[model samples]
Target: MPRQPASFLPIADALRTRIRAGDWPVGERLPSRAHLAAEYDVSPMTMQRAVERLIIEGLLEGRAGSGTYVRTPRERLRMVRSRHRERRGGSPFRSDMAEQGKRGTWESHSQARVPAPDGIAHRLAIQPGDHCVRTAYEFLADGMPVQLSTSWEPMAITDGTPIVLPELGPLAGMGVVERMRTIGVVIDTAVEVPRPGRATQEEANMLGISVGDLLMRIERTYYDADGRPVETADITVPDVRWEIAYEIGIEQPE
Candidate 1:
């Protein structure tokens, strides 16, 4: 689809100027939606959309049952993931964000048994139309969303096992390696390929950012010792809120 111009961009720009000029100082309440609509000669819906953009930009805050107001900006923080092989248990978030003074948390939605598309099936080395358990996750840092991830696992490998639901049962949230071990799957390796891209409107909305924001997209897969593909996931992280660093170890040859 061709890129469509959002009606709120100009409005957002105007409001941003006012905010930066101190016309509406931090903590000042913005005019009511109706008032702004009349001022801008647009519908209230368009005005609301404009305000929402500012809110996502950290320049405004909307109070529940109350009006929107200017918000004091907070320092932006970045999260890290170390590649040290020893750190292979529960989510890296627990250790990674914790060390950076943020409490890391994640919530997953219902797990579904669905037919794998040809591409996903190929990633898992399963037949097209084969069943897989799919789960979606939103990861947070100190209560603010930081990442979105969706994982698919071949039911042929996890069916009839406690680890079928990646985020449930005995080993919930324990990361992939430990969870697979419970079912006798020795996860020996994981592969990740990260690509940078601009976020679409849907993804922008979910991450509380404006459309076309830069983001890091990572595709990861886990393989067992026997070279069987067990799981794969797509992870998206907002570029403004995260920086990806790769740490590699060098080996000496005798």
Candidate 2:
């Protein structure tokens, strides 16, 4: 077979080099695809592919009727998970942001008596048909979305209690551990498991990020002293936007 046209890889590498060398400073528009293709000695489609790769990496952004330009780098924030903050005031996220010298806020929508789905049922250790309160939240720092969450709590634990609605009453915005206290439920332990994931279209919309971007998902469950699961939540953060950290003290052996 005859030699085929050069692939987009070499073109991408050349463009990447130019970007890093500051040949085109941030906010400077890249030449049109046809122009770039002629300059790089590649087909316009190949050149377009190279620019798209850069766009996904957040190195460049495209504007309608305008060319692509270098993107401004955003500073990634730190999200700390220090167990001690569970005892402090406000929500857990608020405490974390405070420690990072930022203001935190959240918006939540809750549905009462919603039937538990299979995934939520498993997390709460309850039957699929069990009644639960489902809450979806978007948490932000200084008006920029940083986290997204969906939580479910079995009504069997808080039904008919003043703390049924998580963001309501005098206990509003108080972390789960404290809100459960009003109903005589002594939450003794919590568990969290985090894994890598890709942002869904909805998640990306909520977090103001691109779809298919990396995300860190944390599955968390709160338990009463009796070892019964009381509530469960899925917390997701854009991987490029935050540095997740954990702190635990070691036990000294005698």
Candidate 3:
């Protein structure tokens, strides 16, 4: 193994970019650590740090009997949701994004507008056939995928807003709570439900793991001041690299 003198973050970021760009397509096996170490001209430990960072972000998963694999959008989002639930009274998105951006050097990994899937349609509380704007992004922090997010907004509402043309100009931030503000829908509260299960093929493909791996599923719905369901987000997090801690506030007894 060689030392780059440069930090491992850049190496990790570049590797992640390759994956996001289809250099390492979904379900594709990556090279061994020794190979990666040689390719990046870094020590094994430094390469390990880069891999660990992505693992912590729920983008990659390693198995006792198998190698690492790319995680799915669902698993990545679940990690973000779990962390958001744990941290109270602040902007969870900003905190998470800032940390993640620092890792991958804040480069855009992937973006696309696709039709919402069935599960997403149900969560958004829209009709089965309704169309929505779906955007998926792989964000890296310190050169790894720390966050994988997919956002869906009803075309009916967003079509009228500047968000309709995201590539043309700057719109709202990635978070639904923040994005809603652009449409005069302020999110004052969020309710979350958490479920646990084995990872599916789709999840395994994205997170770079095998099916049946442990995963945490989180469903979050945002509400406006008038109690309207403004947005719903579903997230799946791999159990290996990510964990959420919660603190509850208690009132003093009289």
Tens-digit per-residue lDDT, 84-170, candidate 1: 532646777666777778898998984667999998999999999998999888988888888899899988888988888888787
**Model 3 segments beyond 4 Å from truth?**
1-91, 97-122, 165-168, 172-174, 247-254
lDDT of 2 by residue, 1-254 (tens): 99663487678778988998999999999889999999988888989988886776577899998889988755677777767778785688888887778898999999999999998899899999899999999998888888999999999989998889999888989979989987899888888999999988898778876666789999999999999999999999899889788878688999
What are the runs in model 2 whose C-alpha is more than 4 Å off? Answer: 1-17, 26-29, 32-34, 37-72
Better of 1 and 3 by lDDT: 1
Cα lDDT tens digits, model 3, 12-65, are: 788778777877666666777778999989998888877766665556677766
TM-score of each: 0.77, 0.81, 0.54
lDDT of each: 0.84, 0.87, 0.61
The number of clashing residue pairs in model 3 is 21
Worst 10 residues of 2 by lDDT: 3-12
Provide the RMSD of all predictions against the true structure, rounded to 1 decimal.
Answer: 3.6, 4.6, 13.7
Local error of candidate 1 at 71, Å?
Answer: 3.3
Which sequence of candidate numbers ranks them by lDDT, best first?
2, 1, 3
Model number with the top TM-score: 2
- Could you tell me which 10 consecutive residues in candidate 1 have the lowest summed lDDT? 79-88
- For candidate 3, the per-residue lDDT at 174 reads 45
